[model samples]
Target: MKFLDHPSRNLFFTGKGGVGKTSVACATAVKLADSGKKVLLVSTDPASNLDEVFDVSLENHPTPISAIPTLSAMNLDPEKSAAEYRERMVGPYRGLLPDAAIKSMEEQFSGSCTLEIAAFDEFSRLLGDPAVTAEFDHVIFDTAPTGHTLRLLTLPSAWDGFMSQNTTGTSCLGPLAGLQEQQKLYQQSVRALCDAATTTLVLVARTESSALREAARTSEELAELGVGNQHLVINGVFQAVDTTDPYAVALQQRGAAAIDEIPAGLNAFPQTTVPLCPGVILGIDSLRRLGTLDSAVATDVADESVSGDDELAPLSGLIDDLVAPGHGVILAMGKGGVGKTTVAAAVAVAIAQRGYDVHLSTTDPAAHLEAAMNDERLPNLSITRIDPAAETARYSEEVLSSAGANLDEQGKALLQEDLRSPCTEEIAVFRAFADAVAAGTNKFVVLDTAPTGHTVLLLVSALAYHREVTRQSSEMPEAVENLLPRLRDPDFTRVLIVTLAEATPVHEAAALQRDLRRAEIEPYAWVVNQVLSSLPLTDPLMKQRQKHEQQYLREVSQQQASRVAIIPWQLQPPTGIQGLSRLTHCDLSTSPS
Candidate 1:
């Protein structure tokens, strides 16, 4: 955290999910504020842990943290932010247009893009522009994961150019006056981000190969976006103080070796390393220790995990219910970095082990399916990744041939330009997902879905396409028409919301369930990955971590879902067939609560 306590007006901590972004952000903010600087910490992550970290209630505004004198914080919920932005953008048309028309217009902005734009709208005021710029000496942002943060960093220019192109008309929504002003703010935000002196983009990630690669990609993307002041903070580096424990030794070696392999793209950026503590980091005391190595590793951390052997239902239990139906779609869906691919692989492998034919596929662009399932796969199982590039190319050709076969050159050029929008990729990938779902009718299809934002957008697109067909009262394409019904059918599709045993993960998973329920899709079960409670701990720190998981484990059992499966934090990384088989045989003798 010493690398972070510098003279920057804004510092953004972003990385892959479950990589400790919130922990690092909170710890850094605490360090800076303790140095007598006025620090305003803002969390733009849809799943944020500020309240859990501070043990205090927070709103959308900067509320002074009573635990710290100079620290203030807020969580910018995307949905809430978008609703407000939508109101301001469409409020004027409310009375002018019919109620139903206004409602329809509002629905257009209710997709994931609106969430990004609205979050950016609020983000611009604090980081990009002059509003309340002087109120705090520093504004520290706890941002989302790599793909999401990268998408947002590029949004300023993307939206500005997009709005500029539509100046003449608002595409039947309304006047572009409000959006035009937003465009100017977006430009200003870009300028603020490009300036190196006042702002810094801190890439926070674990010492794993996947996390490092994602950070490097984020660094390259941010650099391409004109954000030159970048720093790579490899969080959760471990030391083998207790060399006798193979787990500790492996952890330390992995961290050290990972640092040596830093991607060339990010090698020029300054780097910070924080040693791992086995215990769960919570509240002020833990966060203070987290910011500095001296305070953190001065003494051997002791784990005071709840002195109880408690657990949830085993992963093997789901095998019975899942294998009952000879064939069905089992979808592992949740926030990014929640181990969806691994869980999907385990489920697919388990079903196949039971002599059922299972086809495992992943729609997530960042999915590591090959890593999860190695070359030595079961005879009854097969695996695939829904390649976005391949799908997009296929979709483009189909759209061009069918929709533009008779169009003139100018019209074809316009259509081609329209196909380049980000929305096109969503539709293309969604078509692939629909095809995958259709495959389940004949054989079991185990699908690992994209992150929540993208998955929700696909559902929204399906609904919109369905409505368009209904309005026209015309026949529909076979795949497009059956997409909704297939997703809505409980017997045909089993959706498992995979999550970590933590505040943000549980909250986000719950929110995901709410979103799915809105579309008439009920999750078949909840899979809690990386539970520390079930493992035997030699380190005192891990014991404390096991203690912390109790509350979340309880939350999941009593409040989150009716059927919950727990996978303990494994000593060895879950990869290949052997590692995945370990996932299905986990013990669940102890009660979760």
Candidate 2:
């Protein structure tokens, strides 16, 4: 509630996924609108669920919420934005340029870099141009998970610096054509973000160690970026009403322990705690009840038991299927905060335990593979992360030494300046991903991919690069050249879509599936992580939450996935070999203690 008090013109709600950023942002926007202030709520997340939360369809442009007359919402869809951006750049040259030239220009615009810059272009307009949002008194941004959001927030300065230093006037962003014209707008956006009076960054987090640690890191990083105006919203803080229920008591204790050992960096921010709601936050009425103590307890509801016919198989079955191939790429991918890293680690551990060579790697910027491994080493298993900074440096050196070897000092200087562009990271990371996939030829490569949006973009880039390789026999790495075909080959790669039994995660996973199928890649199976339906519970709040999870479980098993595996909620955080093994071998048909 304190985060809602005396808010700035711009409010950004961001944190680890599943931390209720969308719920809190929606509630705040509604409250502000109810106070008679015209507000615009925008979701910059590519896998946004504002439509589900608001129970209405949305578009790239603002759509007025039927429930709240003064509140309008929109999803800045990257694909659509990129299409518009491409048109703006290529439209004028339709007949002016040759057909082949036009096709080539369109191909250049199809990469992930274009998608990113296009979305940022839309974001910059909303934040930088006053006249664009003159009708609204406030603008609220419900951003993607921490890692993706940080990259987005840092782009203005990155692009500004890149453009200023580009003497050659050529780089990845050159395809946009009008990027230089938007330099002033990007500068204005950066100024608005850093101006304490104009923007307030709300760091949302769950009362869990991992989420809090991520929030603390984000706080420090944003501060270093000059976005010092910060507020903390600790969501889903729970207290057990039934002392006799061991599961409920343990849950409450875990939350309390996390709060007691709260990160020191978060102590400096203005703090607000939102109690855990008994059910999922959906619709305007439920949104209104958020942040209130009364909503923490469930109303009278039937306690229906989970049916036997709806039961899902254990994760071990999926691992059995995965390991049968001996060697291939296995990707654990889904929306953020759905235990992708944990699932990937568990799969790798299980396979390695079976005496197979396995390589566990992550493309997620915030992934903690070492912590997940818990310092326990397995002779057959290896772990690595595709660190963006290190990859960028290595990639830059390769490009400079190879391409710049024949150039003069001025040409080399220009090439180095081109490498400084933020888009270079995308190229470096893509190459790293390809190399990781290439390893699957000899060993099991389990990749914990980035969140939905970023993952989709990476795949899209693979498609773009694949096309480029076919068009001309360029110097693309063998791994990069073969990436898409390997991903599409069922015998070579298997993807497991991971999700919690919740609305947003399920819907987002479904969206991810659609994207993958479009890319000619079929998911091997779906893994439902952290299911509470099988847990024995006495607390009314816990039971209500349990009842609510059944619908999503059924949805996953009956509709979303042809094959499914379920992992029950752990009494303790699942980390290390023992905890992770429990996930792989959990018997969900029996009640979890």
Candidate 3:
């Protein structure tokens, strides 16, 4: 691969979820290790699947991959890291402080901001402190999806600016009272990332317009952050060998068109393309074969027919069940790149067409709800986004005008400084989410949430804030106070776990379901999107992929969800009212032309 030709000391793989970031990173690491270089692979994603990819158990510290002698890997498990971080921050003051004070400090550390900082602390230690990784020849980072990854990468500058400008001794970045001591380390990390000689950022994407568009946006954003040493890896570029199969031809043509219209921002970088594999990339052998032209198609085709297609229901069946609830909140959530926005929009349109008022909104930082709608409008349907920047600004203005109105200039300055902390966005977005949920009382509200990691954080924040609201009942908003109850209430909230019939997305969605069940929020259904099993295809590669998808589909229907919905792969991208309506109107037996 071009990205591996002259690898830098620090290599970061990042893009949309399910775009094969982990696969590409593992393959690159394996190739380098085979070349007699000592390598350490680290995953900073909250929902890291490095363990699954390597088929080895992982911890926060590096564990040697038994299959590869030269490679060691680790997962920066955010929950565990946050627990340790909280203990470290509060340990020194445990016996000295009163019980109430200690509890308050612990509560402060429970927010999502603390989890982010804790994870970054671990990341910074590896990148900033050279002596810590002196044994490894190369360090590869398999970062979280685009939105979360950007937030993690930009923290050094964000925190530096906040700390430098703040005259007050404290701010909302809770549990990091010793942030000043780590200032030098953060600065070093920043310098390392920006220095082209030390670090290379590989932007991974699939051969689809949406995936490529996201990659372009990420490329430009990182460039603006001074990390201009960028490379683009267009993964899953398909070429059909069977000219007669319509499905195969359509897939190839769509990919070619997406590449032909490649964004100008991504064109500036060195580019590499990895062909679509016939089967899921798992195990060390498969990882080694990745990105090689010879292994693009499977030689041994499975002649055994796939069964259990008749047991699965269509997307409209799920919509029908959801509509039975009448007016309530519907959340389409799962890993990124699994068509969550499209599913949510389709459900919203279906409901609005049923003569009910519907409001569709998104909390995902990188969501393109408008693009998904394709400028189509319904009289009963309204769409909005919980934009972090706008919400934070509005929140800050409200706080300053109400609480800072009577304060002196210095006090007001401190109040404004407190509001400028990065944690403020978390609070602002949470409130906006709660307000959006509150609207369900009058009409249907469908929310397209962020990718798995961010969605998990949002839920965790809800739990933490609920505790705070219970203790300080007088100051909390009515919407905030009622958020958890509404989420946990089965009749009020219906969550559809959206995923593709692929290894990583299916496993990640399963993990997400477990998380929700633990929080007493039951998923109403599971949506298996982009399945190819029902298509009539003669291409060996397409047939291999179809055979591979059956297991995951069976897994979802039989093991994961009580109710399951299947959406077949579409010939065209599903956008606009007409395209979206087809999702709700078509049956599983029908294939798109």
Error of 3 at 302 (Å): 3.4
Candidate 2, residues 448-488: lDDT per residue as tens digits?
97334444444566545554322221267888768879988
Where is the poorest 10-residue window by lDDT in model 1? 166-175
For the record, the alpha-carbon RMSD of candidate 1 to the native fold, in angstroms, is 4.2
lDDT of each: 0.73, 0.80, 0.80
Error of 2 at 64 (Å): 3.5
Give the Å error, residue 211, model 1.
2.1
TM-score, per-candidate, Cα-based: 0.88, 0.91, 0.91
Model 2 segments beyond 4 Å from truth? 144-169, 364-367, 450-463, 466-474, 589-593
**Candidate order (lDDT):** 3, 2, 1
For residues 383-451, could you state the per-residue lDDT of candidate 3 as single tens digits?
998999999898888778776787788677656666765566767777888899999998999999832
